[model samples]
Target: MSADRATTETAGLMDRMYRHQRHIYDASRKFYLLGRDQLIAELDPPPAGSILEIGCGTGRNLIKLARTYPDTQCYGLDVSAEMLATAGRSVARSGLSERIHLAQADATCFDAAALFGRDGFDRIVISYALSMIPPWRGVIAQALRTLTATGSLHIVDFGDQRGLPASFRVLLNRWLTLFHVTPRHDLPEAIAELSRIEGAESRTRRLLRGYAIHAVATRRAA
Candidate 1:
């Protein structure tokens, strides 16, 4: 399927599933959404710069980021209106409505310029979101394109569980599959290829025996 068509379909499915679930999304996702704090720690945003987050469900990360980097402007985009609605409420409650911007847009092929009235972001993050996205690779590519000259992209998602017990891995995979989340088995290779194409510096590390965190690829300033 074409990129646009795939985006449409995925958005439709997410909207259907999250229409009601968004109310309790942040409360429920805390259990299994691992490595998010680590990703946030590595965010190191520049002072007075702009940050964007794709697939930002419920704006949990954005809240933390906004609190951490009060000097930076934060933006989050998601494909589901249900998710954005919750995000909106979170931003309002946190009183970060001015610093953080939330929008409903396809992460894979969204036009940042059109959506945000800007061309690029200084830092972009994708945290454990790739697994639920069907065209995740395209999302990464689009993120790269949306980066400023000195911008960086950060990602954290499920790993291959290479170090975890066989039984645990089996059960975890089974549970994640029910939510349409699949650990991309070839994530390392994919990140390597992305770095090569962008001619950007990349670093990857396995955390917790690859049961949770995988690799972090960064394209340093050119």
Candidate 2:
């Protein structure tokens, strides 16, 4: 499929999947979505910095991050209009609508300047969304393009679970499939190669016996 067509289908699938799930996504996933709060706590943005979340579903993370760092500006994009609608209401309820901006766009090829009127951001995060995005590597590349010289990118997602019991891994993957999630086993090597080519550096840490992975990559000054 052409890029545009693929994006359209991705959006459709996301909307269909989250139309109702968005309401209970947080409560249900909190048990398995490990390392999210740790990633947010470590996102130490620069003074008055700008932060963006590529797939900011339900605006949960964005809202928490905003409250964590009141001096920063927050922006988010998600392909699902259904999720964005829920996110908007959540943000308004948190009384953070003024500090948070939301937009509907595909994460794989978004134009930051056009969407948020900024060339780049000081911090960017992707929280457990990569496994659901078919073109996850493309989304990572596009997100890197919006990183300022000193900016950093953070990602936390399902890991290979190699350190866990074989039976557990099997059951986890099987259950995750219901949500269209496929853990990217090669995430470490992929980001290492991407960072090398981009003149950046990255490191990933496995959490909970590889149940989740967290990465932090920083680009050198130009």
Candidate 3:
């Protein structure tokens, strides 16, 4: 499918999926959305820097990052209005409405300069959002293109259940399928290809039996 069509489709899916789920999103998602805190803990944005989160659902990670690095400006973009509504409220409740900027845009093709008045960010993070996105690899490339020369991008998402028992893997995958989440088994290879093209470096770890936390894709200096 074309990028525009894919974006429309995904936006529709998200709108439908989260229209009601947004009300209880944070409450229910906290239980299974692992690796987010770890991603925040590991983010070390430069002093008085800028950070952006692609697929920043509910503004959760950006809120945490703003609190953790109060001096750094934070930005977020997502395709779903339903999700952004909750995100806006969350940012306000955290009293970070001024510190963080949220936008409704497709992660794969958004113009960072147009969205946030800049072409690059010091740090970029993507939580467990890639699995549900059909053009996620394009999102990674767009994200890399928007990174400062020395900035890094971090991503944590569902992984192949390579470490789990067959029965458990079957059950888990089935349950996740109900939510339209697919554990990308080829993620490491995708990252490797991206590294070669963008001169970025990546490291990934399997958590909870092959669920993955991938981080710190640093762009090479010019």
Candidate 4:
């Protein structure tokens, strides 16, 4: 399929999946979607810098980032209109409409400058979104292109459950399949390769016995 067609289809699928799920997403996801808050805690954007979240579902993480770093501006992009609608309402409810900006765009291929009137961001985050995106590597590369020279990209997502019980891993994978989420077992190696090619520094941490993975890739100096 063409890129646009694929994006549209994915967006439709996500909307159908989250049309109702977005309402209670944050409340229920708090259980299994681990390491997200930790990733937010590690986000140290530059003073008055800009932060962007690639798949800012329901604007949950973006709201947290804005409240945590009041000095920084926050931007979010999600392919699903249904989710963005919920996110918009959440941002408005938080009275952060002035500081947080959101747009509907495919994470794998978005024009940041055109969408948000910015060239790059100081800190970019992808929290648990990679597991659902079909072209996750492309999304990571696109995020790298949207980073400032000194910026860092942070990611937290489902892991391979290597340290967990075999039965648990099987059950977890089955549960995740219902949401169309697939743990990218090669994520660490992919990040390493991308960082190497871009002259960036990369780090990975396994959490909760490989139930989740956290990664950071900082761009190199020119």
What is the C-alpha local distance difference test score of each model? 0.85, 0.93, 0.87, 0.95
lDDT of 3 by residue, 1-222 (tens): 787888888888999999998888888888878888888888988999999999888887889899999999999999998899899999999998888999999998999888889889999999988888877798888888889989999888877878878998889788889989987888878887887789888877777777665656888778
* Candidate 4 lDDT, 77-174, residue by residue in tens: 99999999999999999999999999999998899999999999999999999999988999888888889999999999998799999999999899
Model 3 root mean square deviation, Cα atoms: 1.3
What is the TM-score of each predicted model, taking all chains together? 0.95, 0.98, 0.95, 0.98
> How many clashes in candidate 4?
0
- Candidate number with greatest lDDT: 4
Instruction: Rank candidates, lDDT, best first.
Output: 4, 2, 3, 1
- Pairing residues by index, what is the TM-score of model 2? 0.98
Total clashing pairs in model 2: 0
lDDT of 2 by residue, 19-114 (tens): 899989999989999999999999999999999998999999999999999999999999999999999999999999999999999898888889
How far does residue 66 in candidate 3 sit from its true spot (Å)? 0.8
Clashing pairs in 1: none
* Cα RMSD to the true fold for all candidates: 1.4, 0.8, 1.3, 0.7
Q: What is the descending TM-score order?
A: 4, 2, 3, 1
Give the Cα error of residue 16 in candidate 4, in Å: 0.4
Quick one: RMSD of model 1?
1.4
Deviation (Å) of 101 in candidate 1:
0.6
